[model samples]
Target: MLGQKNPPVDRGQATAIIVFILGLGALLPWNFFVTASLYFKERLAVNVAVNMTLNMVVNGTHAGHTKDYNFDSWMAFLSMLPLLLFTLLNSFLYQWVRERVRVAFSMVAILLLFSLTAALVRVQMEPDTFFSITMATIWFINTFSAVLQGSLFGMVGLLPSRYSTLFMSGQGLAGIFAAVAMLISVLSNADGINAALGYFITPCVAMVAILACYTLLPHLEFARFYLNRDETDKQPIEKMPIKSRDKTVLKNSEDPKDPEAPVLQDYKLPEKHTHNQPRLSVFAVFKKIWVMAACITCIFGVTLAVFPVITVKVQTSYRGYTRWDKVFTCVCCFIMFNSMDLVGRSVPSLVQWPRKESRLFPVVVVSRVLFIPLLMMCNIPDSKLGTIFSHDFAFVVIMALFAFSNGYFASLCMAYAPQLVRSRDCETAGALMTFFLALGLSLGASISFLFGYLV
Candidate 1:
């Protein structure tokens, strides 16, 4: 009977659920990418410098006495673009495609394109041409990575309500595993700095492997489960009114000045039900999403804008600290912030004073405002406590608070999104959220670059 309200249990939903779980497993390897980049920063710099010089020579420009470009810094910034682009593209595709086979094919095609591009650059570039080649390679790899990441996440969004448990459990497990790996990395090494730095690649590789495994799962299952197969197999569900007294009233009420309304009015009804029609225009859905995306982007932008400066402040202001101490501080900060985020997301009712959707807007605005003051505090010259706290503790506290606020705000936003549209439009809503997330990151990074120049 419930299947009458919502579509039946299907293989597509089952597959999506499985994929979502595997995607969570992928998180375990996140550290690998981070650590790999950090471990090879010096080498990357040397390669980039050599490549830049060679390119300058080949292009008939002066190669002598070039100011060193920090490859690590540039790579960090450049890497984000691929992910952002993929996310934006994925959002569009998720709405357009109906079949899981089509979705998977599109995903693979994009990934292959990125991989091939990277491979071409890698094979063609000489050691002296490393900087440009490395940047190109990183972009290609990132594009492929982003596709993988986006597809996995997108699959989760496609899961049927009944199988949502599988996705959530997978994500929860992934978080736990990530925390455990970090803990192990921290404890195993005599010098926590090396451990922390060295362990980044593990998480990224794990993510890739897990995602790859998930990629091979049954695509048809997801299509059948997530989508209304009967509707999809036919000409789509008809937007017919429910056989209820309320529907009759709704139909009659459409003609505001109708004489027949008097006859229907005399027959009082105790209860009524109306069938809600869904919007079919993809453009209209996308436009609605754009507004929410813009808001989220602005919020995220304000938060991320200061990240680069924060790291610099930590290094310079807390100069006297040991390497291990610095690592410890960073790890502690990450833990605190993520912990708060987890708590807020998991137990939103505990923190939300007034649990309403509108509350999110104010929360986001206030969080952004808080960042400005917190950032300014870092620049205080005389107050050792302020400086020390800013360097070691302030970021953690600010990020934690930001995370908490964002969690509550996101949950509220998600809850409110469906009400703004029809039931079928939830996927589009998710896509919009991701679109804004990418936009926010890109904007924040760019703004950070500008701020770096000014400061």
Candidate 2:
């Protein structure tokens, strides 16, 4: 990590560099899953009631199966284990693979797992139950994809901090493209089984192809230009004796307005501090900021929980909405959410929010409290708000707000993680974040099933 420091790069150069590093299509696959989920629900009408019922039964069989048993609660309870395990595994493996290899492997892994799960559920379930299992399977794939994306973010952050700005720009562009793709897919004459496969398969394959090409592109290492303080300060300083008044007078008289005066001014630089220490270890880093990590993890759980449910809500409440409308709504919401998220990522650089040690806890607590009301609003009776807003529009607005909150929280969490941990520990911290994300998603899906049954 030791290197000579160069002058800071301009914003244009930084953005270009991040795009070059993260690749243009890095996020395409991530967005593909989002689009595919919407496409299936709208086009195929894949109901998940059977899968939820099965999971509930599985949970109940393990218990006494008493008359007092609550199946919804049981499903939520049983889902925690896989979610936790997947998260832990994701965190541990995030650092194990090389960056380029990790991207390829993760894409293939998700595609394969998703395809297998979808095919299996399609074959096994009756027509009524197919959608439900398919959705559940999508949840599993989503958790996997999230872990991979978090690792990518962590690795990009490791690039000299200057490159962070570039990462955001690239993310923004990718999000825009994803939104456009979703819109196109919805407008096209795609529906039923063929449409579902087309929406899901085509983009994923395209993304894999694009990413493979990226692997062959040469990597640019900009870190070489920057000089460390130790390297710069090692130059010896020469001792200069004070001149007597006569000598100073004679020199000044002879060299008044000398051309070298500007050189002398440049030479009078401030003393540089030298501390050639290794980056902190993972444990040391976590010890300093575990609370923030825990809070972010919980928020991630909540966000993941809410997203899939939005699709469900639309399907349930606005049955009359055209397939295109449903797909368009989901895609537009995703784009809007990601676009806002990209903005939030850049906010810390533009403005200063409260940054005191004690302030963080309160800020996070307030954010969590805000989330509760927003979530409750989503569940409010459509009849009550029918006068003010259509159920569909209200759902979309609530989801957009949810996305906005998620983006803000995610940006803050990324910013805080590095400050709390050591440079080397970034990968580990990232993995832990992903673990929490997966745990949250699994729990969220289980919760959705339980709630669906209860309602």
TM-scores of the candidates are: 0.62, 0.60
Pairs clashing in candidate 2?
4-226, 4-227, 5-226, 5-227, 6-226, 46-131, 47-131, 47-132, 48-132
Steric clashes per prediction: 21, 9
lDDT of 1: 0.49
True-structure RMSD, every candidate: 10.2, 10.7
Candidate 1: 10-residue stretch with minimal lDDT: 265-274
Please identify model 1 stretches exceeding 4 Å from their true place: 1-35, 46-67, 94-129, 145-155, 158-209, 212-279, 315-324, 348-366, 379-395, 411-419, 453-455
The model with the greatest lDDT is 2
lDDT of 1 by residue, 1-455 (tens): 11122223343344645554564652322223333343345444555577677788789766565456576567766667876887667656655665354445534543443344334422434444555655665665556545444444444444432222243334435554554555565446446334543354444455445546555564453344344523432322222123433454445443546433222221123212212344346568766655455666776576567653443344324556676564553464445544554455444323433433454565545456566446545544443335534454565666667656554454444334333444356555555555566677678777776655444
Cα deviation in Å at residue 211, candidate 1?
Answer: 3.7
Compose the digit string of candidate 2's lDDT tens values, residues 217-244: 3233233222122243343211111232
